[model samples]
Target chain A: MTKSLKTVQLSHGGGGKEMDQLIKSVFFEAFNNPILCSEEDAAKLHLSGPVAFTTDSFTVAPLFFAGGNIGKLAIAGTVNDLAMMAAQPEYLSCSFIIEEGFAIDDLVTIVNSMAAELHQSGARIVCGDTKVVPKGCADGLFINTTGIGRIIYPDVSANNIVAGDAIIVSRDIGRHGATILMAREGLALESELTSDCATLWPIVEQLIAANIPIHAMRDATRGGLSAVLNEWAKASNIGIDVNESAIPVADEVKGLCELFGFEPFDLANEGTFIIALPQAIAQGAIEVMQRYGHCQQAAIIGHATSAHSGKVVLTTPWGSHRYLDLPQGELLPRIC
Target chain B: MTKSLKTVQLSHGGGGKEMDQLIKSVFFEAFNNPILCSEEDAAKLHLSGPVAFTTDSFTVAPLFFAGGNIGKLAIAGTVNDLAMMAAQPEYLSCSFIIEEGFAIDDLVTIVNSMAAELHQSGARIVCGDTKVVPKGCADGLFINTTGIGRIIYPDVSANNIVAGDAIIVSRDIGRHGATILMAREGLALESELTSDCATLWPIVEQLIAANIPIHAMRDATRGGLSAVLNEWAKASNIGIDVNESAIPVADEVKGLCELFGFEPFDLANEGTFIIALPQAIAQGAIEVMQRYGHCQQAAIIGHATSAHSGKVVLTTPWGSHRYLDLPQGELLPRIC
Candidate 1:
């Protein structure tokens, strides 16, 4: 039997003993289920009406990073995107571009992380493919995942959001970005931050179960909160006025941002989220999100408006408001 | 406006002028669809019924070459995989990993090529992402695409293949492989044999429309026809007898294989396919395939048998037979 924890080689792509060993040791162990165990090139399944489809690719540098690895990021990224659309993530396909000579132990660790994350989030990886490149041709690993889900709710999209809708954030901002920066900079802080990389499906499911009319939902990702808010404003053809005091920022994150001369709002986030709910139910939504997030900081940070269409204005603590645009360019590289 | 034929730089990932230019010059033009034109982070759509999902990563070395680039191959590769499963190619997600300092023009060319290919195949690239790695961490470019298509048929699986089925090869074997070899080795043939990297969805759609019950199907990719056939035989616990004379091979590929002491059967094929059907419907299926291939060279190269179980035996013209097995390893690295 091939040893399980050695560095991986091109032999793994040969579809022979080494390949089998790798699958059994890593992917199969992490992603195994009745459907995945079949190991077909495509997955076949029975389904009901109104399906939702979403796909994402994860290319986090160092593969194994400070707070989370590429595997968790891959699963969480797609599942969160689906949740934002009010779709229950059902099946997923994982494709890997593995740099030859990557350590098997690292691959196994990453795969195991993915399995744990999937199990926790109630998502399954149903089909997958793996490819290897010459040692110097790629980083240790890059993963791309595609997901399919059933849209229990027929009405879901940014188009559904109305001008009077109220915007609610699930929790504090900038933890994911802060953790990544700290990891990269090797900076020590009074309060070490962990990524808010938890799955939002449960929270989304809860909201749907309560029968709330959601106009729009999005997880603050590459562009951060400001980017997603600006995109929502633009996409919905409405204006949003957010109070900086109401936007939840961890005190430590605020301190770190000030020191680093970065705006926490524009930083990358993996765990934070934003939701647009009917104005009348905004407070109730915040209450529920606080119960789930266990963060007292959940707040009604902004309100959607009819005037000054497609722009987001942030009201500063000094009473002056400034237009908050989507991330203009690269703030941090490889945050995902 | 970004010029169409300019070099792509790392700044394309920055969501600035380069990024807008990249999307406008290539994706907007080739696809020419409503969804792709929006150029949003996600593509919203309507859907119904069961769906088939598949993902593939393309890390072919020498990213740019004579026949196709990584982008086109990336789209065509996933679309073809979906078609092989008898699914209507609907949506695709493209993710890129760029080695820093790679050419921006090459990236644009690749994206345009992919757009043209996807448009031709009747598939749309709705969602995509980009990432960059420091130089030496990757080859110039690597692309991973994941696709979701509706399953138009009720049943499709390699397990559906029975003990006695006819196997067909759409056309000449190893053109894709030989072309890669010629480019890599600089071995000139009598005529240029560019890789046949076209999408097979049209031909597949025609086959499905013919209402033939295909027991099994597969693209003879990395490990080649021999590898796929062996996998089917093992999965179904049956034996296969292939007619060596009936097996189509281009003269250039044959000459190179002989000179390099290689077997055409074991080489990677980017454009060819392998399919299994009941013996009675085999000829009809072949007719259906040829009608769309525009290359009327579909041939019955083999039959599934109960004897010599779990093996692929090739019958030579001289009445001699040779046992063919799955390819042991890569004949060429990153040949798509």
Candidate 2:
């Protein structure tokens, strides 16, 4: 095949010879596997017993950001959802909608990022679909990923949190939202401030393997830490008491939030996660988490309490308390 | 909740209270079910044995056509892939990328179409994600659906077609492609011509119930009949002899093809499917398929042969024959 065109055309998605060549040179080379190479309408798998199914769509602005591109985020986002359910990320279905005239080289770069991210979780993209629309019909590219995995640890539910359980933050919060804000504004920060976009299967697998009695776990994505806490409080019907000073927020994120007039707790974090477990095992869990580079700032930020059921209470360092409500308005669009 | 805004805002996908309200009022009510109501990061499914996984992204232009909208096409397209593999469509993940300022009422209508189409397959949309881009960032709306189903019948491979097997189409060809062309061109026809977009699970279920010996099955979506036949011939390494006159094409479709100087075999069909089976079972399959209202025109158009292996030969009514090649260039974009 000759490399005459630098950008994708309608013919690239027309289900013709050009489309076949695009799949072979791009998608097939990056996501090579026996099942995918079969090129069947559907991929066949021998899945048995309980499974975890999840999905996410990535349409972030400026397709490339400080820490990762949309393709990496697409893979990590869906894989993290499965890992939150104590499922080992196994297979994923990737679908892309690209605008006509999108640079083929840029697409290849994004796809390669996706392949690199999948390596961290040992997940495979078995089946996929691609569609190209007119140039003005879409901005650039949007990706949707749906994942299925075997449930390694069952009954990991948000409704399972109970009084006396400790809530732990996996890492510093709000990096993703802050990074995107800076990228959109064309800011050059003095310190390295990047989105913490990464696959969480490794850390989650460690927790499951350690036999920790995890009550609930979730990644703080769109609505950030605030939304996760509020949902957990409502679902578990328990009150959560937080120590404001303990939650880790990097100085760069705090600075960006101050400049943007936003709350760090309400901003997104791609790799940050919240875990609920028995108070006795909080230290052990933190130690295990800190072994990973991304989890260096892990700390216990809150605990489930019996008072004021179905609400999250935040205590300031100066001894004042207030409800950290679920985000009410648009914090930021396309943060994930 | 007040029905104040007629259009969707960026806040509706901001992972806040507005987004929650939108979900409850629109998607939740239409796709109400126990699994979807769990409100977890992922849906827990108890799947066992062999399973089929597939994905499709629907960027169909105009959003709505005579018989279906993008939502209906999204569900049917993925479900049909599983049904073609003899898999019982069960679970699906739906993701949407909506443009800001898109009408909320139109979104609801499209979503309702999706729910209605799911009834034909008994497949549930268990987990979903929604995102909103700024106005002009996307063209109204786009949807991606990924489906998983249990494989009731195994080894139905495209490469399994052998000599003496008959090729049967479930319904008339080219209706879907022509319908979109007419809609885009704003043409007025005397007779109604609508897309064949529909769920094929019901008809496929009946065929499975009757124990027809199916060797290969596929839907002629983007590249239509010519793509399927050419692919089948190459994959099976067998010659395919098609009686061009025996293939069914609706009057409206034939007229549109004539006007556009396009071949009917190169047109798309969303709901239509092709099956390969022993000559002895061809009539049995056709009888079961024609029982469906949309499948009244079901017929066998070709047979697998040993002569001219890896080629699809078309026999005309006037005693002429030629090779039917796979579609080339961009016949249509975003047809499904």
Candidate 3:
């Protein structure tokens, strides 16, 4: 069926027979499930207990990028949000806004990527909406994913961090932002910096199963580590002090940041996350992350402090400390 | 704070300080709620029992139409999908993709419109995402809303339409499609036509409260009445026979359809809905709709039959019958 179409036509989103065929052949075929195939206005689910709901709209430029595409980001972004809240990712609703004349092949690749990403988190795209606008009305495509899941280990929040909590980062930072920057600059083939775009549920699940006394957890997405740490400081009314040299940054990412005059700590990491926990359990958490979560670079890089509340301070390698403020102005637009 | 900005810039979506300010000053100011203001990665919801989940992406051209804007349509559309499933609209997650340089005032207006429409169903915007693309990457703005609610009256489905069930329409159809067409064609003010863009949860809640014994319920949205009837027939494996003259069509909508060489049944309706129920209580259902649902033109227009299964036959005033097929091609794009 996909072979019959070269590019998407406006009629494919006209809510007509053409639209039905397009949906059945492309979308339904990729994200097929019993609940989705029920042909109902909405998917019916038997849910009980406290649930976590999050949504994200992916408008990453270039559509295709190193290591992952917009479709993978859409699924993993929403799933990670739920996982950060100690939620077991379950159901997701996807919506696509496509431009007329988008290539059917590219769309197939994107949808297939989304289906594969969902498998990583054991989540299902139970319902979806599609809209195709005329040429120039939109870029190639924008995907919005909203997810709901049961809160397995509740009380994980940005405001839960205590003054004595240690902050641990999963893996390296800035790969996602550097990869996108490289792609946008047409330097992708010259570098090995691929996006850390992945589903974080397995890591989160392991952390929960290990009974690490987590106070707060967050993915360093937009505004990167600086944004998340600053938000945590303000939300929890505590100061966060970090050792600059202790944080992990890939060499390629650091080189890219140097070339662009950007800070690796201020760039996004799609698959990386930060956890705040008691200092006593921080090493145990890191061990679990490395041994079972597949996060070999996981390390404790900071700690919450009562002094200088509502601030994030970073101590440089030379012992000079300065505030790590929330990123200001535009670093990158449509990076994810 | 909104007065400080004339237009949205790429920085507003950079996942930085500017984006945070924009979100708090605009989105949070309008859709303020405890859950949304919690500042967590995901909104926590305590949901139980059978739940209905649906999603819709609104890329309606012109952004603002005769009766409502894209924001209102986004809210109403997802709510209607849940309502069609006999769900009590409870929570919604909204994600927006905005074009750079879009007017801040327009964004405020759209956000406020969404907040206002959400009041109709007592649903809360619990979580949301915002992305801004570079200029020309998208039109003014596009919104995707995903909703979840507990199904109050279960067993209502298209496949539940048994033979001899009465079919009823809530009110006149095609106003939404005609209004958008007029707006897009620059003929909006030439006539008094307006889109029937409204939230239908109140009407649906009333029907459920009245114990309508609804077998099937659907909003005649994109693809309109013709699509809904045909889909119901096919899903239920029953035949649907409709009286063409009995289906209400406002004079303005009819005139516009005539001018455009389109069929009223094929045009869209945002607020309008069709229902299938026991023939014995058809009049009672109409009375409930007219008196309490504010559907003054509510009337019985058809019934399900054992013959001609999987087909929708429309009886003309001339005593001729023709199959009412699902709309075949583009009638109007971005009709919402």
Candidate 4:
């Protein structure tokens, strides 16, 4: 093969002449198919009735980093989205944004990582796209993911969320964000921290096995407790009141945030969640979360309310109370 | 407030400090959820049976392409995915990867387009995420999408594909790809080429209304017709032989491909399909497709076989036989 031009260029990502050339030279020849040839905007089929869909993007820097890579993030992000709906994710597709001169090895690492994660999630990588930009236009790698999960639950909806619901969180908050920050920032901390990047379907199975009625559930991510609560409040047209001290946070997280001027509540957290259920069933939900070694710190941090409207308030240890607000900005980008 | 950074950086994309800064500064503040907090590889939920799933990604370069933009692509891709599966796409989540210094107008345009598309598709943007990257290390924009659709077909699977099945196409091949190629390549031509980007759920509804015994179906995408056939071959474990003369390709596409060194059989198509039906229902199927407007060029190019053993072969204009292969690599990468 001729080394036409060793470096990636904006055209590669432009979907123009250069992009056509790269794809024809590499991908089309390798993956040739008639359906792929027409290159329409969306695939059409004769499939009918009830479908699940999802999307995600990986902005992981360095492309290849510790624990996992961009490709892995691509798969995990979308698969997790589907799982959040209590659906079994089945299909996945992705788009890639690569800066010029991005290492092909790094791309491969990302792809393989995605493959591994997809396999673990029980999903198939059915469709995808890739683009390359100018060298000075982008970081080495970025990936966007979309996934579809089979609709196993027909009755579950935000409308089903009700008041007097119990709140249950799985695991500690901010592990993934804190760990990544510590690792990248080279925080000389003797305390070991790792990204809480595990999958949660197994834990979900445990909860479902309890045969309990859970009103609503959400993953506590970028906005941490405040964001999740606010969303639930707006969706269910109710307020959520919480005992701040009841929530779980690690000593390491407290130390790191206070030192870095980060707020534990506003800062991002990984592998955490908030579940709304009847106050009576709150204990059962927590018991299910505890079965998973990951949820050892599960707690009932709040209850849904109808009075305060779309706001979440927390009763802090201090004499005064604090109203937790939705994270004001990007607290953490691609923690998942 | 502090001019921390306007453009995205590798650290921001990473699951670390910079990533934290980006999210804290932007997305987290806008939308927060407990599931999102889980920073785990996945957020799982327990569901009440048969489900539907779909996923899509967007990589329309220039961040503000002519026809639409990344945002529209993101939404349309997932919506269409659900539609093809015969599911009513209900909820959606969007993920974005943006480069630094991108024109805010372009972002707004993309978002507006997405909002419009979502409306047209009858889907709600229930959840989403955004990530920013360093200017030099990222593109102007990219998006990933996932959606939820309710499954309506009690009996829909590849298992029904069989020897007597007839393959019906929804429309002419090459419109979407040719138009994209022409537009992206700046190919000045007598024929104005534009993408055949349209929703097919309505047309699909018409097909189902016909009440024919439709067995297997697939959307022609990355690999085009050959890829779909290959998938059908293995999926249903049956062979299919196509008659090239019977397959339809627009004259514009033919002329454009020859001029650009492209192959109509090896391009990316988003809005084409290969549907399998019992031989008895083949003509009726085509008639139904033609009535749908989108299926005007619909043709019965092939039939399922048992003897050939999961292989797809094409009988050419020259009366010679050739095997259709899967695209080995990306074709017109990032076209979506």
**Candidates ranked, most accurate by TM-score first:** 3, 2, 1, 4
Tell me the number of clashing residue pairs for each predicted model: 8, 0, 0, 107
Candidate 2 vs candidate 4: which has greater TM-score?
2
Kindly report which residue pairs in candidate 2 clash with one another.
Answer: none
What ranges in model 4 sit over 4 Å off? A1-56, A62-172, A188-191, A199-217, A229-251, A274-322, B1-52, B62-94, B100-127, B134-138, B147-168, B188-191, B233-241, B276-281, B302-321, B328-330
In angstroms, give how far residue A251 of model 4 lies from its true place.
Answer: 4.1
CAPRI quality of model 4: incorrect
lDDT of 3 at A111: 97
- The ten-residue window of minimal lDDT in model 4 chain B covers B39-48
Error of 4 at A49 (Å): 14
- For residue B297, what is the lDDT in candidate 1? 85
What pairs collide in candidate 1? Answer: A137-B138, A196-A271, B6-B105, B7-B104, B7-B105, B8-B104, B8-B105, B9-B104
Q: Residue A13 CA error for candidate 1 (Å)?
A: 2.8
Give me the candidate number with maximum DockQ: 3
Output the lDDT of residue B248, model 1.
89
Model 2 over residues B1-336: C-alpha lDDT tens digits?
514689989988888778888878888898999888797999999998999999999999879988899999999999999999999999999998999999988999999999999999999999999899999999999999999989998978899999999999999999889989998998735559989999999999899999998999999998899999988898899999999999999888988999999998999899999999999999989999999999999999999999999999999989899999988998989897
State model 4's lDDT: 0.63
DockQ of each: 0.49, 0.88, 0.90, 0.14
Of the candidates numbered 1 and 2, which has the greater DockQ value? 2
Ten contiguous residues minimizing lDDT sum, candidate 1 chain A: A11-20
Query: Across all candidates, what is each one's fraction of true contacts kept?
Result: 0.41, 0.88, 0.90, 0.19
Off by over 4 Å in 2: A2-4, A189-191, B188-190
Per-candidate TM-scores read: 0.93, 0.99, 0.99, 0.69
